[model samples]
Target: MNLRQLEILAAVVRTHSTIAAAQDLGMSQPAVSNSIKSAEASLGFLLFERVNNRLIPTPEAQVLLADAEHLFLMRDAVMQTASYLKAGRKGSIRVAATAELSESLMPQLISRFLQNHLGVDVSLETHRLDTVLNYVETGVSDIGFAMEPYPRPTLDQTPLATLDMVCAFSAKSELGRLQFVTPVDIDQMPMLKAGSGSRINKLIEEAFQKSRVAFNPSVDVRFMNVASYCVEQGVGVAIIDELTASCRPHTAMRTLPFRPRVQITLAAVSSNSRPQQRLVKSLVKYAREEISQRLRQVSKERSLKGT
Candidate 1:
């Protein structure tokens, strides 16, 4: 019936006498007798038979003993698993990041995390901004990096970084010579859309609306990789995240600072129902440090240009 009762039963059978079982179990004879009596009352079966003042276990007692021992063993196994997780031992982490974050930041952050927790497996996916948000919302992934900032009421969003869209063109392009382009110039340069449904797109639209700058997109593409490929091929001028500018810097493409441009907010999103994350949260912490480093570079460059 109860664990103590089952243990008492086991001790009684092994010791072969109630008096001996009580001494071996560190309990009084009356205590062991009460346990066995309570257990039989609960299960409606006598677990032991008295033969010449010795306790002989019934058939049902043998079966109950097996189950009782198994219960304690399984409980120990569960406790060990919890200990492993708590100590940051073997397990897999599932993360989905925006294409922009994936390019420059995730590689180094993940590399460092992997070095320490070698036994922890990381499953990383590159996702579109919109896709990243949906994945986090639906619990498809444990953590998500996204710039497709829309309100997710159920999800807790932590804004990690804010980046500006920089112009990308062939090294030979006219605007690449200038350190930075003004809003008026941004209007004149051929626009290459970074696709629809992104916080960057909305910011661009709002910036243009405020300045009343009329510009037409020369090319439209999804996936930052593909858009950068278009820039590499000299398709047209494009505005992209700074990560795109940093990527493939020697690939016959040039980066130009754009003004009144879109701002991309990189956020880490996870569901409210998510378990108290240990490793994944540590990754997010590292990512924040990386963002700080990047922003410092951006600020330094901007200050030097002004001076």
Candidate 2:
């Protein structure tokens, strides 16, 4: 029988009279009686016996009532889950991010999100910027974090933060005394470079060109973390995004703002074909706040240090 019929059956069985059942269910007595008759017809059996102006449930009615109760419980659970999903408190969110962000930012963001949303499941994938965009474009990831100039025309991209590029150097180096590093300061010094064809490398080259200096590198690396590590080891000074350079407590590596302030724009990328999931949008908002707060904190600390 249908859920409404089963509900009427349950009400009648509980109240022991159609008149009482009708009052409990906000229906007329005849309406309750008709619903019981319909249920019984659908079940091909009598559900109740009328005697002494009272209703007594039959064996068949008891069995059906048990099943109906369980069905109602399951329906309640489904509704609760739907409410949770709608509120962005439950569901799975798949994210793909560039190596720099995945290592430096995603861990804290994902952890805080999980703490706030206990029922949500998060899957994180780390790759290069190109792969992160590909994952979002192909529907393999619900959201992606990568640096701009985002080349993917198939995905919607929102700029999240623009982090300045910083010159990273060993704490013991002579350049560490400077509050900022100008393109002229590092012109003659050996430098570690980002990948030759990377957007960051092009930006670095343009910065040097604007200063009327030649761009040169002692070592070439594909990742910002690698460049930072090389700077820490006194291999050479490198310009890398502030987020990647300042994420950890580094005693050996110190970062200074680069003069003329080369910047890397971080963006949230999502597929055009799929609607943005509630949890994914929540994550994007969380990430933006987290990064902004972090940058402000860093700026405050540097000001206090008189650097």
Candidate 3:
């Protein structure tokens, strides 16, 4: 029988009377009696019998009562879980981010997101920028954080923030002696850069070209954090994004503003093929706010230092 009929059967069984069942269920006695009659017709059996003017459940009705109670319990649980998800308090999110974002901002971003949504479980992975895009496009990840992702029809990009490209070097180096660095300033120095075809590398190339300086890097790494680490070891000066530069591997690593102000947009990438879930949207919102707040703190610290 239908859920409404099962509900009426259970209520009538519990109360042992149509009037009492109707009162308990907020239904009329005639309506409850009619529902029982309909259920009996559908099942081709008598669910109740009149004995001494009392409604007594038959053996078949008794058998269904236990299962009906279990089904009701399951229904209630499903509804409660739905409520939790709708409120953005329950669910799991699988996230993939490039090495720079994962190393620099993702730890605090995840911590703050979990603090706000205590019931959400987050799985984070670090990949190269290209792999991050692939993970999202291939449905291997729910969300991706990348810098200046190229346009793709299969992927939807949401701009989170615009960050400057900075010059990172060892504090003991001569480049750190300058207030601000330019393409001409470190054109001939041992230079570290991202992979040759990357967006940052293209921007660095253009900047050096505009300044009439050579754009040769002694080391071309896949991740900005790796470049930042190399700069920490005094291997070479790195032209990397602001986020990686902020995550100094050692106190001796220093960052300076690169002249001409190369800027890149950090984007939240997701598959356009998959429908965005409420929990994923919540996580993105949290990421945006967390990044903005952290950047503000970084700016304040830099201002205090007069850099």
Candidate 4:
């Protein structure tokens, strides 16, 4: 029988009379009686019996009523779950990020997201830049954060932030005294470089070449954090993303704006094969807002410092 018929039956069982059930359900007595009769006819069983001018529930009626109550509960739960999903308040967000964003930004971003959406669960995976793109393309992750150029043809890209590259040097070094470091300033110095063929390394080399200076590195490393550590220990000056260079607290190193303004664009990648879910879209929006606020604050600080 239909939900309306089941509801009328339940109402009659609860109120013990067709007139009372109709009143409780805001329907006419004949309508309620007709619905109950229709339900009983569909099941080919008598749901109630008349004894001493009063209606008494049959054994079948009790069983059907119990099952009807369970159905109502299940319907309510389904509606609530749908509401949560529509509002982006409950779901799991799987994210993959490159080393730079994963180490420096994702932790804080995810923490803030968890705080705001307490019903949502987040899974964060860290990988190299290329692997992060793979995760997004293969649907292993819902979203990905990485540096450009975004090479995955199967993924849609959204630019998040563009960060200027900065040179990090030991606080005690003479070069640290300069407000900004020119490519020529570090030409002959022992340099700690990013891995060969990396995007950042190519940018650094290109900047030096544009200034008519030779590019040489005393040591080569696979990650920016390692290069930053080398700079902190006075191994040599290293040019790295602003996020990685700024992660250290009360550091023994100083960061100077590198000229002539090498920059990298950070972007969010999602699969093009499927429509984005509400939760994934909300996460990407929030991440973009946070990154924009951070970049604005950095710009303000730089403007004040005349750097």
What does candidate 1 score on TM?
0.64
Q: What tens-digit string does per-residue lDDT give for candidate 1 at 1-307?
A: 7667777888898998878889998999999898889888989988889889778899999998876765554454455557668888677677888776687678877887887777887878787766676666655567887764677777888889877777777878877668776556666666678767666676776766777886577777876656777877878777777755664454677777777666777778888777737987888888788778777876686577662
Model 3, 85-167: lDDT tens digits are 88886587779998889988899889988888887778787888887887677666789999988778899999999999888
The whole-model lDDT of each prediction reads 0.74, 0.84, 0.84, 0.81
Where does candidate 3 stray beyond 4 Å? 1-90
**Ranking of models by lDDT:** 3, 2, 4, 1
Better candidate by TM-score, 1 or 3: 3
In model 4, which regions exceed 4 Å deviation?
1-89
Between candidates 1 and 2, name the one with more favorable TM-score. Answer: 2
In candidate 3, clashing pairs total 0
Model 4, span 1-307: residue lDDT tens: 8777878888887878999999999999999888878888889999999888667889998988776665664455466557658887657777898777777788778877777788887878888877677667666677898877446678898888888999888888788668899988887888888766877788888899899988888898877877888887879888998878766562788888999889988888999898998878888888888788777777787788777
- Cα error, residue 200 of model 1, in Å, equals 1.2
Winner of 1 and 2 under lDDT: 2
Lowest summed lDDT over 10 consecutive residues: which window, candidate 2?
A: 72-81
After superposing candidate 1, which stretches have Cα over 4 Å from the reference?
1-89, 186-189, 298-307
At residue 257, give the lDDT of candidate 1: 71
lDDT of 3 at 59: 95
